[model samples]
Target: MVAGRLSRYFGRRFLGASLTVFVGVFGLVLLVDYIELMRRSAGEANASALLAAGISVTRVPQIMERIMPFAVLVGAMLCYLNLSRRLELVVARSAGMSAWQFVAPAVIAALLVGVIATAVYNPIAATLQEQSKRLEDRAFNNAAQSGLQATGTGFWVRQRSVDGQSIINAASSTDQGVRLGGVTVFMYDLAGRFVERIEAKAAVLEEGYWRLVEARRYPVDAPPEKLADHQLKTNLTLAQVRETFATPETVSFWDLPFFIEMADHAGLAAAGYRLQYQKLISRPALLAAMVLVAAAFSLRFFRFGGVQKMVLSGIVAGFLLYVLSKVTEDLSKAELMHPAAAAWLPVFIGVLTGLVPLLYLEDG
Candidate 1:
């Protein structure tokens, strides 16, 4: 199936169509997101349109990557529908060729495209996304010094040790919990009774403890005491803090293994990275599945008047698949299901849903 003049021709057609659709969709996404960003920042000071545009563009690759399966679906639909319209498929069918035979090239092409996207394009997207976040912090977050942000609350982290339990909060923090501003600490004894409240203008993560500056401590039964400096013991490390808010997409496929290991060692949740790793490895199969879905909707000619409806149905199905994946991811992140099961189950279901229909229609 991978070799022959006809196979080459079909492969070229499929690859060309998919690439064109990917480019077009990426551009459309960039324009829409850029405009949205600008609209949101309309009243904000120092919001550069060019910077916003650049951030939007950088985000396009990642968004495009997510929708690549949909592109494959549309591309295959377009390619096959055109062939049917031009009577190419009719000729092939008359020559004793079957749908499965011709669809092989497109399936192969989709597999290759998925592999390249996961391996190469993903890393670049992640880097640019990180850059976009930095730009956002500078533009609106005052370089991330403002803690708890617009929501009127801050992030919370916890520590439990022989000393008792403590909850930490900051208005904003660095990637690592190394530095924080507008910090507060609440400590409780082994029995969960309140022991003290500590407030600080700033906090820095030092070896074995947190170093607080401009600190005031209020004991449970005593008045507030001002202090120049204070130390609180901590088991959390810099890596754990850095990984806390790090979403799966920020880590590349190649780096995910190491990231997961480090995150687990640092006592951070590693399920997100594990789930992303599973998804990355399953991309090729998912794209091929999309090709099958396209074929299921594409074999009819436009002259029959129902082709448009089928195409719409196919596109809607692709969107549903994306939505399903997101839902499963949330469930996995919440620990309701095993990470491997959550990531792979959706892909498997999507592939089977497409493949089974193609098998019955093509050969049955």
Candidate 2:
């Protein structure tokens, strides 16, 4: 019963501390976002434009969501540091609580925050990012061609043939860019002659060859009824197919598998999508690591007198860890590093590195 009471008490305290930290951080983000919007609006010639810009500025939270790990680190560090500064940590230790016991609540809180970020914040961020991009494009590029649009069933794309003159309107694509669904390839000679027409249910990209599925070929002089089901060949490769689709970020996590398979069928590399997939799976571990790292940096306040030094050290350590993660991600994407290694190595190293400082200050 005593242990339960103590745990509840600690939980409440940690919760309050975390809430305080989040508010402070979120306020700072809002302030910066507002200031940026103001600066951008200064050059605008009209009130309506400024209003639209202001509305777009609210999307900063989505950008900031990407930095949630940093926020968790800073917030958890502040929570522990504040507790230590108020002598609450000392009192808890005097009451027979170990350093680990005092830290357990904050660690758990950070993990919870991480889970919320992954499941909730990420999708919201993705949506807001798309909105922001669309706003910017409409504002700046009135004549720019929009990318392919997707529905629940398929996506549309436009690509140029190898001759770099003919435009292909592929109504939908599959097999990672290798296969075209509901395809209509319009062939025009240099003189814009109605040379030929090809219709196919699917088009599969192979090395220097495209295998058309249930295809019908028509020559300029041939009647439409004379066309027969036949395979059409092309010089397009898997790389060309994916190039027409653009980045994987436009697709949501739920849609990655389908795209990955499409890429595989096209004989193109799906390394970027693969990395994102692995990273998504490692979300829980990454969040747990952030909490541990935060604990390691801030849990020393009881013994350390140099607040500025510790804060700077924590910031530097966090920055280095983030950089390391990016480098590992790049290497993994390049196929030079194992997917598992690229995804989890930084987390493992961060946890171990964090534990060393925590142990030295709290236990030793």
- The prediction achieving the highest lDDT against the true structure is 1
lDDT of 2: 0.63
Error of 1 at 206 (Å): 8.1
TM-score of 1: 0.78
Alpha carbon lDDT at 291, candidate 2: 65
Off by over 4 Å in 2: 12-58, 141-246, 301-304
**Residue-wise lDDT of candidate 1 within 1-364, one digit each (tens)?**
3235666777788888888888899889989999988986787696789878876876677777788888888888888888888887777777677777778889888899889888998898877766665566555644335322423577678888688999987776543346666789999999999999999987888777889888999998999999999998888776666566456777788988988998887777788899899889888888988888788878776677798888888888888888888988899888898878877777787777677777887777
TM per candidate comes to: 0.78, 0.67
Candidate 2 matches the true fold with a TM-score of 0.67
User: Can you write out model 2's per-residue Cα lDDT over 45-161, one digit (the tens) per residue?
Assistant: 542455445445546656565566676677667777878888877777667887677667666766676677656766665555555544543343321222234444344443344
Per-residue lDDT for 348 in model 2? 86
